[model samples]
Target: MEKILTGTVVLDLTRFFSGPQATLFLAGLGAEVIKIDDPATGDPTTFSPPFAGPEGVSFHRKTQADMGIAYLKRARGKKSVGLNLKAPEGRAAFMKLVRSADVVIDNFSAGVADRLGIGYETLREANPGIVHCSLTGYGSTGPERNLKAYDLMVQAAVGMMSVTGQPDAPPAKAGSPLSDAIAGTFAATGILAALLHRNRTGEGQSVDVSMADCLFALMFDEPFDCYRSLGLPLRQGNRIMRFSPFNAYRTRDGWVVAGAATQDDWNALLRAMGREDLAENPQINSLSWRLANNATVDSLMSSWTEPLESAEVLRRLNEVKVPCSPVREIGEVMEWAQLKDRDMMMPLWNPLAQATVEAKGPGFPIKFSASKAAYDTPAPLPGQHSREVLMNLGGFSAHDVDAMARRGIISAP
Candidate 1:
C-alpha cells in the first residue's frame, strides 16, 4: 500500500532536536525529506557527540568525522543535502530546490531566516503553494523569540519544572527533552492539516510553531487549570490535587501505581486490598471523606502493598478491575513482548558505528488501517545526497554542481 505522504518533497532546514524530530515523522511517512545542512559544518549535532561509545559516553573529544548519537536517532529516513545558505549562490540554489518542493521547514532562531534571505516571503515567491513551517524557541512575533532556546531553558520558561517532581525538592524537567519532541509532533500535525486545506483551496500557508507555546498548550490544558481551581501546590508528588489514594505505593520488590477516579474504581481498589467491607464505611467510604484523609488512605494502602511483591500487587489489582501497574524499569519494559510486538523499540542503523542497534525510540505511534509507514533507513552523512538532489530535483547540471562545490557553497561529498 502507498504510505500516507508518499511522493511528497520536504526541504528540511531544521537542526538539533526539535526540527529534525518534525522531519523525522514526515520521512517515516514516506516523504522525501531532504535535510539541508551547512556545507561547512553540516548539522552541528553530527560532530557534537560521544558517538555511541562505552557507557553511552566518550571521553575523547569528538572530531568532525563523528556523528552524534542524537542525530542518528532523530534523522531516520531523511536525505542529507548540504548547502551554504549563508552565501548568495547557496540561497539561489535553495530557492531552486524549494520551487520543486511541497513543504519547507526550518528551526532557525527568530530573524535568522530573514537575515539568510530565505524567509517565508522569499519561499512563497519561489513557490506560491509551498507549506513553510518554522519551529522556533518562541513564536516569531513574540518578545522572547530571540532568546536562546535550550531544552532546560524551554522547560523552565514554560513552567514545566514548576509542577514537576516532589513539592519540597528542586524543580525538575522530565527525563526526556519533552518540549522539542512535542513541538515536532505538533508541527507534523499542523502540516498535515495545512496540506488538507491546500488540497481544497490550492493555497499554502505558513506554520509557526513555538516550543514554549507547544509545551504550554499541552501542560496548561488540564493540570494547570486543576491546580489553580483547587488551590493546591503544583509540585506535590505523585497524587492528584483532588483524588485520594491515587499514588504510587511501595511494594516488597519495587513499586506499584494505582488510581481511582471514580466510585467503582475506588471500590474495586479496596477489593484489591481485600478490604471490601470498608467500601461502605461512611467515615472513609466517599471520595470527599477520603480526600480529607489522604494520609490515612495512603498509610492503609501502603500497609496492604508493602507486604506483597510488585507482581502480586499487580495481579490482585488487575483481578479486581482497578487501574494499576508496576513501576517498570525502562530497560525491562523495552524487552517486553508487548513492546516488541508493537515495534516500539526500533532497529536503527547507526552510520557512525556502522551497525544495526536497538533503542527504545518511537516507531510510528499511530497505526493506520489502510496506510503504512516505513522506518528502515538511517540518517545520512552530511550532504551525502548533495549531488543527487541538486542534479535531479533542483534542476542543476554536473557543471553547475561542480562550480558550486568549487565555490564552497554546496558539499561535493
Candidate 2:
C-alpha cells in the first residue's frame, strides 16, 4: 500500500524541538525527511541531557550519543545530515536538495534564512512547488521576531505560566514543552494543508508558525472570552474556571481528578458517594449554584473521598459515568494497560544505553485502514547518516563526500 506521504521529500533545516518535531511527524507519515544541521554543533538538543546510558560512561559520551530521551522520542523515522550552512558550497548543496524536495522546514530567526540565501523566496525560485514552513519564536513581522526563545521562555511569555500552578504559589511552567510541541503540530498541519492545496493549484506557499502565537491560541475559547467579556482572568489552578467540581482532589492513596461539569454527572457523583440528598439540594443543584457554593460541595466531596483510595474513587466515578482519572506518575503511566492497549506507548531498544526503554509514541489520532503510521526506526546519532544522505540524496561520489568532510563543511559520526 502507498503511504500517505510516500513520494514526498522534505529538506528539514529545523534544529530544536519545534522544527525537528514537525519534520518528525512528516517522516512518520512516510515522507523522506533529510534533517540538515551545522557541522560544528548539530541540533542544540543533542547537548541538553540527563544521560540515560551507562552509569559513568554516559557523561563522557559525545552530545550525539547523549541526546536527551525527548529528542529520541521525537526524532524517530528521520535521517540526519551535517553541513555548514554558513559556507557557500554547503549552501549550494542544500539548495540542490531543496530543488528536488517537495517541502522545506526551518526555524531560524526572522531573516536568517533570507540572509543565508536559502529563504522561501530563494528556494521557491528553484522549486516553485516547494512548500516552505518557517517557524519562529514570535513571527516574521513581529517586533520580537528576532528574539531567541525556547519552550519555557515562550510558555512564560504567552500567559501559560500565569494560569498554571496553585493560586498562592509563583507562576509555574508546564512540565512538558507544550508551546514548542503545539507549534510543531501547527506547522505540520499547515504543511499538510499546503500540500493539499498544491495538489489542486500546482502552487506552493510559505507557512509561518509562531511559538508564542500557538501558545496563546492554545487557550482557545476561555482566554478570548475572559479578555473580551470579563477583562483579565485570574489563575484558577486545577479547578475549572467556568465549571464547578472539575478539579483534582485528594483521595486516601493519592490524587484523583474528577469532573462533574454537567448536572447529570453531578447527580450521579453525589449518588455514588451516597449523598443523593446533597445532589438534589437547591443550594447545590444547578451549575450556577454549584459554582457559588463550590466550597461546600468541595468540602463534602473531600470528606467522602477521604476514606477511599484514588483507584477506588476513580473506579466508582467511572461506573457512574463521571469523568474521572487517578493521577498517574510517569512510572504508573508507563505501566498503564490502557496506554499499552491503544499503542500510545512504544518500547525501543537503546544500543548505547544497552537497555530497553519505553516512551510515549504519537497519540492514536489518525487511523487509516491501509497505510497506518508507526515508528520504523530510532533517532540517529549526530551525523550518523551524514555520508548516507549526501551520497544517496545529493548523489555525491564517495571522493566528493570525503573532500567536503576534509573542508569542514560536513561531518561523519
Candidate 3:
C-alpha cells in the first residue's frame, strides 16, 4: 500500500523538543520533512548535554553522539539543511524550498517568523497550498504571547505542578517534559487536520499551537469541573479521589501499584489477597462507602502487601485480574519487553561516537496495514546535508552553494 504522506514535502523550521517532535511525527507518516537549522549553533539542544564527550565542552564527540541519538529518532526519513535565516541569501533559499513544499513548521518566539518574512501570510502568498504551522509559548496574539516559556514553565502555568507531588509538600515539576511533548502532539494533530482540510479546499491554513494553551487544554475535564463546581482540586498524591485501595503500596522489595476502581475489581483484589471476610463486608462493598473509609481499606491492603515482594504482589494481583504493576524505574523500563515489542525503544549507530546508542523511538499512534512507520535514518551531523539539500532540492548550482557558504549564509560541518 502507498504511504500516507509519500508525496508531501514539509519545510520544517522548528527546533528544540516541541517543534522537532511535531515534525518528526509527520515525517514518520512518510512526509519528506526538510529540517532547517542555524548554520552556527544549530538547535540549542545540541549544546545542552550530559554527553559522552570531554567535560565542560560544546559539541564534543560525546555530545554529538547523544544529539545523534535524538536526531536519529526524530529525523528519520527527514533531511537536514543548515541556513542562516538572519541573512538575505538564506531567506531566499528558504523561500525556494517553501514554494515547492506542502507544509512549513516553526517553533520560534511569537513574531520571529514574521520578522524573518517566513510567516504564514508570507509563505501562503508564495505557495497558497502550503500548510503553515507555528508552535509557540503562548500563541501568536495574546497578552502573554511575548512571555517566554519552557516545559517547566508551562507545567507551572497550567496547574500541573500544583496538582503533582504529595499534598503537604512543595509542588514539584514532572519528571518528564510533559508540556513540550503534549504541545508537539497537539501541533501534529493540528497540522494533520490542516493537511486534510487543504486536500479539500486547495487552500493551505496556519495552525497556531502554544505550549501553554495545550497544557491548559489537556487539563480540561478535571480543572473545569473544579472551577465550575468544586473549588480548585486539592493535590492528592498517588490515590484517585474517587477510588480506594488504588494507590502505590510498599512491598518487601519495592513499591507496587494497584487500583480497584469498580466493585468487581475490588472483589478480585480482595480475593487475590485471600481476604474473603473483607470482600464480603457490606461496609466496604460500595464505591462510596469504600471511598469514605479509604483510610481503613488502605491500611488493611497495606498490611497484606507490606509482607510480600513487589514482584510477587504484582503476580498475584495480575493473576486475580486486578489492575496492578510494579513501580519500575527508568532503567528497568528501558529493558522492558513490552516497550521493545511495541517499537517504543530503538537502537541506532552513532557515527560521532562510533558506537550504538539507545533512544526513544517515534511514537506514531496509528498503525497502518501496509506501509509501516519505521526509523530509516539517523540525525544529521550539523550542516551534514546543507550543500546537498540546497543544490539538489532548492535548485542551486555548485557555484551558488559555494558562494553562499563563503558568505556564511550556509554552513556544512
Candidate with maximal lDDT? 1
What is the C-alpha lDDT profile of model 2 across 1-413, one tens digit per residue?
Answer: 66799989998888778988788889888898887889898877655564444343243444333445556676678878899989998988788777778999999999999999998999999899999999999988877889999998998887788778776679899999999889998999999999999999999999999999988887764654464364324566787756788777898889888878777888899877988887556777888877766677688789888899887898888889998888899889988898777787775445456555433455434668899676577777777888987777778889988999999999876
Against the true structure, what is every candidate's RMSD?
2.1, 2.7, 2.8
lDDT of each: 0.85, 0.80, 0.79
lDDT of 1 by residue, 1-413 (tens): 78889989999999888888888989888899999988888888776644643224353544333456677778888999889988889989999999999999999988889899999998999989999999998889866779888788899998889888987889899999999899999999888888888999999999999999999998787567576667667886888766778999999989999988888888888887889899769888888888878889999999999999999999988998888888878878877888778777786565656665433356877678898886658877778899999999999999999999998999977
Residue 62, model 1, lDDT = 41
Estimated TM-score for each candidate? 0.95, 0.91, 0.92
Candidate 3 CA-lDDT value: 0.79
Better of 1 and 3 by TM-score: 1
RMSD of 1: 2.1
Better-scoring candidate (lDDT), 2 or 3: 2
Put down candidate 3 lDDT per residue, 202-254, tens digits, no spaces.
Answer: 97999999998898887655644554354334666887776887888999889
Q: Which stretches of candidate 3 lie over 4 Å from their true place?
A: 53-73, 223-233, 358-366
Candidate 1 residue-pair clash tally: 0
